[model samples]
Target: MGNWESRLYSVPPQKLGEFVQNSLRPFEDCQNKIDKTVNTICAVLQEAEQFPLVISVAKGGSYGRKTVLRGNSDGTLVVFASDFEQFQDQTKSPSEILHKIRDVLRVWQLTTELAAQVEVQMVSGTLTIQLSTKRQSITFKVLPAFNALGLSDKPSTWTYLELKRALDQTHSNPGEFSVCFTELQQKFFKNHPRKLKDLILLVKYWYEQCQEKLKYAPLPPVYALELLTVYAWEQGCRTEDFDIVEGIRTVLGLILQQEQLCVYWVINYNFENVTIRNILLSQLRSSRPVILDPADPTNNVSKDKMCWQLLKEEARIWLSSSGLNESPGLSWNVLPAPLYTTPGHLLDKFIKDFLQPNKIFLEQIERAVKIIRTFLQHNCFQHSTTKIQKIVQGGSTAKGTALKNGSDADLVVFPDWLNSYTSQKNERSRVIREIHKQLQACQQKLDLEVKFEISKWKAPRVLSFSLKSKVLNESIDFDVLPAFNVLGHKNSHTAPSPSVYSELIDLYSSSDALGGEFSTCFTELQRNFVISRPTKLKDLIRLVKHWYRQCEKKLKQKGNLPPKYALELLTIYAWEQGSGTTNFNTAEGFRTVLELITKYQQLCIFWTVNYNLEDETMRNFLLTQIQKTRPVILDPAEPTGDVGGGDRWCWHLLAKEATEWMSSLCFKDGTGEPVQAWKVPTVQTPGSCGAGMYPITQEMFSFRICRTLE
Candidate 1:
């Protein structure tokens, strides 16, 4: 058996303790210096006639826990506001209180150790300040919190529950009450064993050191690692004199092995109570590495899978060293190394590297596109024989907005046989059967290095087939929808004839039965509309699509939701309404789409870029469709199709997610300025549509009057 202790002791026992303490000296000094600065700021607040709202200030977070790391150690200055209780009473938002505190803090004009005046940057959530002396600079995150329970004993069930309820009910912001229980948080990790604290410092040190190595991947919060260390100690024999190195190794090992480690403490709250237990259980069962904040049950510190994967990979690297490697008869059970990840930075490159398709995937998709196009030209029907009129590539891949690992292509097959709207409506079923049979025959004949699975649909508008390539070891879904091309081959911006939609309107029994049934016919125009957009707009579309996928996977959402195509159109509409340039801000574009999504019910978007309501038949159809209900995004190609009709729950979920992601690093640049959304489009309601001015644009019946959110 390998000497695990010897491996851990290889650094030398005395040196290990000295090395860790020595490494911690700078952080200790930084924390102390920050404490002094915080004290000075509080003193200034107390004396200043301008800062009457400031009540008290205290050190919290890493400094409070005594687990601050070297380099950039984060300490929080909890500013208790005098108007906090009043704000709660008046039902003011957390941001409102924070901004009020921030405005007062800005007026200090106080001198720091190094800088002439303190440098303050006001972000949406918190205030960040740089406090420096001659030799060292400390960064402290100033949090404006309320002392809901001042100097009280551990909070009772009702106290915690009421705070949580307030957080949930008030101002729709998640993280609204993050600082509400700062005192409780400080007390949770207040009196841990010295060795365990040392081990925490060591794990945090490892985490900080690896920041440069895994810059692209997100890391779980340091507090999570600290909690893991505590869990290891509490569960595996609580010993004061336990080996510090062993503890470090065990914590890393647990992190690597933790599929789902739900760690919590029942000291303050009763877990036996059904309400509290269910809440705790829900937190535990949430997206993996679920370590609930011991004090506040709402905050799951390890919800991000990318962060967990990155930490796990780093842990594996550390454990692979001498002595720490798997001993005889023991399994470290580590997964293989991750694929070589390209560095992610500069919104466009990040989207391309992490989110957009790579060269290999693109090549595979290109090959698949070729295969489908060839099959359409050779095997698809013309008259009664097998031939196609036009094969258009649609969806994300065609629009050049596909993500790296997630994407699907649409092959719009315009058959020569299906002449008019009635013919297509009556014969599409048999045509779908024939196309399905022919696709199978082609797959059998080609016998390519791919596993093809064909799906059967009730209406079967599109021939759905999933292709798994043997070489790429990835799959690309292809939906071959047979259509009738009323508008012949044309560029992306060219307008299709009004007669095409007129033909569509002729077939519908009632105004409610719009052209969604003839969606396949307008596939070409749909593809072209997005294909002709600016490069920046395409990238923005990719970003929105990426966020949508995240919303689906993170929320585990199911059932019929708003289609990706609708969101894509919404992004374009936002861009056109705002910048409409090739070099516009990507993050702003992303935020605009999110804002639009939150305002989905009020959305009334339509574009006459492809087909305007010129003829009375098409005009009446669109006018009725536009004023029908909420979220009216009329398909530009097929005006009868209202693509925005979906369940309201999905839109609500997206709005909730957008509210959360507004403060994420994804939507911010290096300077921490939030990407501001453009003024929403002016939506035209039913009462105002008949203002005598018929056409909004040069094109007939192309008016867009959207009501911008106040």
Candidate 2:
């Protein structure tokens, strides 16, 4: 065993709980002293004659939330002033109010009855007054803020609107008005279960240890860690008397994944009003580690990525220490990104804002595609017997579902020498090698740098490379796959005859080929299948793709999941079966697709857009393919391709993630009720099954298959 494992096993599990109980408990005397100190400060600030503009003084921060550590005497006091309500510019007005408060503190320290006990100083160029007591030497930070929430516990929509307006005007410091919502911030934690507070204290203590060890490096604010602890407890173990060590381990594990953290709560504000909804979406879509302050939507407590990085380094060390036992699975199953209870309109706006590539990016992609086509036609196969017949652009870029900042192009190179599926399969490696060599030879002529991803397979099917040039902001990735020209320079809108697929099925059945062996040959059909959809349907596809990518990033460690193309086809199928109209609700469509994924065991989806189902050869092949696996999404363009079949895919992981997402805010409506999914069937029922080329048994399949006359 490792050092951490040995050290961790030395301590009994019950002793860890006792350690938390004894070492982390707050002292009664210290609590009494801090309370007296806070009362003294509030009483002095409320003196009517000395401070006229000061409306009320209240304590804030960890002390106000009752989650402060034992030895930590740090506290914050927010002084609400009447003048702040009328102040037009926060950049100037808050400074003026703070100056006045500092001036009063300077005078009161000398003239007041508690003169010798207190020392006050200004914290230069900001709205903070640092006060220290001479006896215990406890420090307090005082600030003046506008009373945005007033006496109401639940802030109104106008309150959020006013806060949003103030935030928008003051981009220099978006969190300038955070102090105004001190009460809500305090209440956010004050009302939680007492054991949750203990978890926060333990997490705070751990954070302090990190600070002491890494004093030179910056760390995320203690408030961010505290919020993270609360989230861990709520999501992982919400009982009153849960395990303390488990809570610490979960938080430490979460800190390691800080790059993906995008947490927020809907207690203070939600996506209801249009202005607040847009603001919330914009905030959520910001850079990583976005732990939005529950009280103030404008304040992202964990905005600095570098600080999180430093803390994450410390977390890794501690996670391997004796306290955590180095167990990774002890952490919560919470997703780092918060799923918002988005409406259909808001979902549309989110797609437009976050998913769709800009016009310039699209144009650049098109230019890159043209350049690649030119390279393939003129330069790639110059010295070989196999010449380039035609190149078709595929993947998301060709289908118009490409995401922003994610640029990829798929070029299906149909060689003239390979006329059948067998030749394309057997001779693809040589063709790939020839194209790779030619690409290196003509690299300087294209004025672009190329980097190839070395394949582990001796005869890899696809040639993957990245191109870097001054013409693009970022590198564009290319996948060059060699396939036979089976459909042969036909119009993409037109479907192929049954003879095309008949020959393909016969070729595939006779050889030791995988299901999607010749899928690259039908790239044009695959692109056209999606590219011909309505604009809104494409937008929905983008949303589904975005969700699938998130799941892929998270579940990659488990095993290989389904390909992005299968989910794309599933989305198209969902739209076709659930809502065939050009305009449909995006949230409902997204929900329907996720719901289908959760029921992947019953999934048997396909389309007849490019192949004729009436043909005996194609129909029999599809029926036999669908009967082989539970998740049977056949490639619409190629009859032999069951894109979701085989033992290679781990659908259970995706289904587990999908089940969790169904309960998240993403599937919830504005009223906090679950958004109903569209009435889409898990299995595609055939109108009528043709006569017995393949045997169909009731025990083998759940759905019925009729044997029609040939």
Candidate 3:
């Protein structure tokens, strides 16, 4: 009755243990590096173990690591990956991967231990066996789907070439195959161990027979993919993964000089399709762990639409394969998690692990430094030694955040230095504009490939910048804030509104941080982000291309929008959305943010403070929308002017300028009219003023003072 996780582990992969600790690129969280390291470790483990069960067992212990095993227990193991979706709806759980592998191993371990007594009758994708002394033999292999647990079996025929001169090689007993297998298993553990090569050879005859029987006719491209997917097993387990070179050859004729249709052929294609069914029955008979197609969505509204597509496509391709046209099939049923197991979500736990920096995070500090080296080269457009560190903030994956279907990417931009700029609020606007420009160009022209944009966000009068780039097919967003040294406290870094941090994300991305250093395709930070976690996990990583968009104003106003903040939001939404997270649960993680934001509410409020656009001059014009109160995602719940009003902190800071405006203290000499917040005239406060405002100053965009009163 129990499900996959409750079952025992599969065989462990041989850990290559050869990974170099990767550096954390400044853009990446330290914890993410740990996840990557864990995954790589698991990948290596999977790599070393050519056996079917080894992959399942090892990946379960690692993060974002999964092995989808397909093959008969008595035959060879074929390993593939489960989907890596953030909303969980599209993929399998790390824990589930581990549990299934463990269960597979447990069954094999126990079965082999009992081998002396139980006989191994057949070794197809399924296994059959009978008690050594009994007339009946049972065969079993793991099934892809099953509602009930325990055992199931089927009868099959085996005909060997009748020998003329030889003594009887076939056992005389009706169920001798099972008995001999059992005897072999018992002997295997007792001695130092039957060498693994010999164990593999034991199934050689069966492998050939299975392939010969199933080989059929296939179409073109499908045949190529088959060669990529299946032909390697014919060689050795060491060559399991896609050989890009070979894939290129198979798909594009092995010549990189030109992009064209492939000339490759599926010379020795075999059908592992029906064999899968056969193995399923065998696993059932052996009481092996159940296998499930991960793309099927659970009760979670997180649609498997994406995953289902992948499954169907794979199935379709396999069916069209040269040797398996008759076996055309599709998802019959996707069983719910097995019975007698924990109902709690393991991904919830995985996200929970991200709430804070653990010891693994320390490893990333080192990684971050390295990432800086890589990213800095491209980010040097601003030309300062300016460095950035990763800071955690609140936010969410696109899913479950709002009416929007999925979570959007938010990147936190933290600078190592540039305390001076945080002091002056007016300078931030110009700085951010230039930073945005530099980054936009950096991504296109430099090794960093980072494109960025910046725009005005008032209230607390914070600036917003969005960074985007591509890896594979998806666009990645790096939402950032620009601040000076003023806000550099633990948990919150304050800066003058025109801070240097986000500015550098732009500059370095262009000029390699102006050191004009090494050119790079991806900053070390970007690489680690890619390496540490899979962007394909979900669309949370879906966008980051151009910061400029049709809806920039609308996007930032909806949330605080800091990268770190958005990340927290993702975890919260993941909890709510069910890995399948999203659609309606918008405020899922606000409670936690409520506690954390109190300390930085003033700053957060600052982000909300916007200059009034009421334009009392034009009675009830622009004010119409502002006055129409509705529960909107970005709307301040109450007037930001008061503490009880949501976003009050932002109004509080802006109110200082309002008071100055009301007192007629904001008039500047150049405007010849009353101003709100700008350099006060010398006659009013001369000593406090800097050099008179010029038409084209660096702070023109940030402060926006001196204008001809048109």
Error of 3 at 126 (Å): 20
The model with the greater TM-score, 1 or 3, is 1
- Give candidate 3 misplaced runs (Cα > 4 Å): 1-288, 292-342, 345-362, 369-631, 635-710
Candidate that scores best on TM-score = 2
- Cα-based lDDT for every prediction: 0.64, 0.72, 0.25
Rank the models by lDDT, top first. 2, 1, 3
Quote model 3's TM-score: 0.22
lDDT of 1 at 278: 55
Cα RMSD, each candidate: 18.2, 17.1, 26.6
Q: Mind giving the per-residue lDDT tens digits that candidate 3 earns over 400-445?
A: 1210111233333445543443232444454445455554455444
**Per-residue lDDT for 1-710 in model 1, tens only?**
22432333345434556667775545555556666666777686566676576666766778767676655566677777767662144255457655655676676644334232356667777577766654445566777666666667477677666666675666534334656666777777776777778878877777766665667667887788888778777754367886665566667767776664556665667454556655654554455566767777667776676768777877776677554543321221111110111111246765654465556657766776687678668745543564577788887788787765537878877777778766666666776788787777666665454557777655655678776654332566778777676666665355666676676777674544444877777676677777778877888888788778657645664544677888888888888777767898776777788778877778887765655545677656766776666787878777767777744336676777776555444455545455577875646332233112235432333433222211
lDDT by residue (tens digit), candidate 2, 418-490: 8998898888888888877777666556642332342333446778776433322234567888889998978
Q: Which residue pairs in model 2 clash with each other?
A: none
